[model samples]
Target: MPPPSAPDCYRVPTTPSSGEFRDRGSKFVAVLRPVRSEAEALAVVEEQRLAHPKCNHHCYAYRIGPGTDRWRANDDGEPSGTAGKPILGQIDKEGLSDLIIVVSRYFGGTKLGTSGLITAYREAARLSLLETVLAERVLTSPILLEFGYALMTPVMGALSQLGLEMADQEFTERARIKLEVRQSEREATVKELKAAIAGVYLAEVHDTFVVEGLTVSLPG
Candidate 1:
């Protein structure tokens, strides 16, 4: 386990990589993808397992959130602590979060020494994380607003003025927009936005909804 008090930044790969090799006649193939949370990490692992049903081993690990959510790793059938921990350690070393990595081994006919196993797993994970495209640090906050096309221009303008990061905008009978307000300015900006379009808009906080893309929400 990495020191609990270790620094909080890590890197993760941006793209998936596949490599196949035979050790002593056994076939091994590794597939790695960046993942954000345990749920996402596990989902990818399961998906790959399903995709390669006959593979001998499917091991995975992931780190999510900020320092609050400590890194986690697992080795499916490799040594007890070998596969997952090393992969996760590399993530921590690279200061990465919200990423997942999985390695599949088919038990090559030749046994890779413990050291070989470690290197292969570590290299696979390292390469995967390295492929990722990273963004500068930005705090994200969730917000909901209700408006109509009658006020789209003003609403968008207010969004820019308030420096609120727009996430999702839905258009139907009503315009339902979601914002990822920067944490530092979220409260003040929300207030400012409300005030800016007070009479013209009907915005209110809504239940928390998690969607992909910069922002997304169902039109209200």
Candidate 2:
């Protein structure tokens, strides 16, 4: 309910790490970084700049913090807005944050028109973002829940609806479940879980980190 209180952000990758493509006479180099903050994003840009000093320009954009909604973009030395704006546009279009994309350019002695430059930068940015790994983030409190098959329906249903994560589950005399709770909602959810299960379940609190997002388990 209420969008799970805006869980802390991680990344959901939509593209590969690095890709190279030619646009007109310019050589476009795109690089993707999984970032957690604006500072980290700037640091990455600096690192890239240092590494590629000979490149004509280094343009970048980043999003970080909760919901990964905070974002910034820079075109570096290209046009006033040509490079960074396109890169930022791609990031938003892809619904990605806590991430950064940098396009390194090596001029090839030809001038592409304004529209052509925009298209090239946009394409490079888009393709770079497409080459990354992404994950959903959730704010959670660490707790363990124990239950038996009899309580499965209600307990599982509640957990799923609340976006609780099962850190571990085992079936023995009873089901030993380690569930995560959001820090803001930890006390309330845990209490509700205990009360909801009552005699059918037992819960214990554990020291842990609040992680955001749910990852799909891959099949072997």
Best by TM-score: 2
Cα-based lDDT for every prediction: 0.64, 0.68
Segments in model 2 whose C-alpha atoms lie over 4 Å from true places: 1-11, 14-16, 67-69, 141-180, 183-188, 193-220
Residue 173 alpha-carbon offset, candidate 1, angstroms: 18
How does candidate 1 fare on TM-score? 0.59
Worst 10 residues of 1 by lDDT: 209-218
Go through the candidates in order and give the C-alpha RMSD of each one to the true structure. Answer: 8.7, 10.2
For all predicted structures, in order, the TM-scores are 0.59, 0.63
Per-residue CA lDDT of model 2 for 59-143, tens digit only, reads: 8887775554488888787767788898888877766666788888888888876677777788888777656766666655567
Tell me the deviation in Å of residue 208 in model 2.
27
1-220, model 1: which lDDT tens digit per residue? 3333223233345666655544455554556666666777789888889888877778777777665465667788787766787787777776666677777777646788887777777766676655567543455567787766767776777777666665777789878887765566555665566555543332443334221122332222
What lDDT score goes with residue 49 in model 1? 90
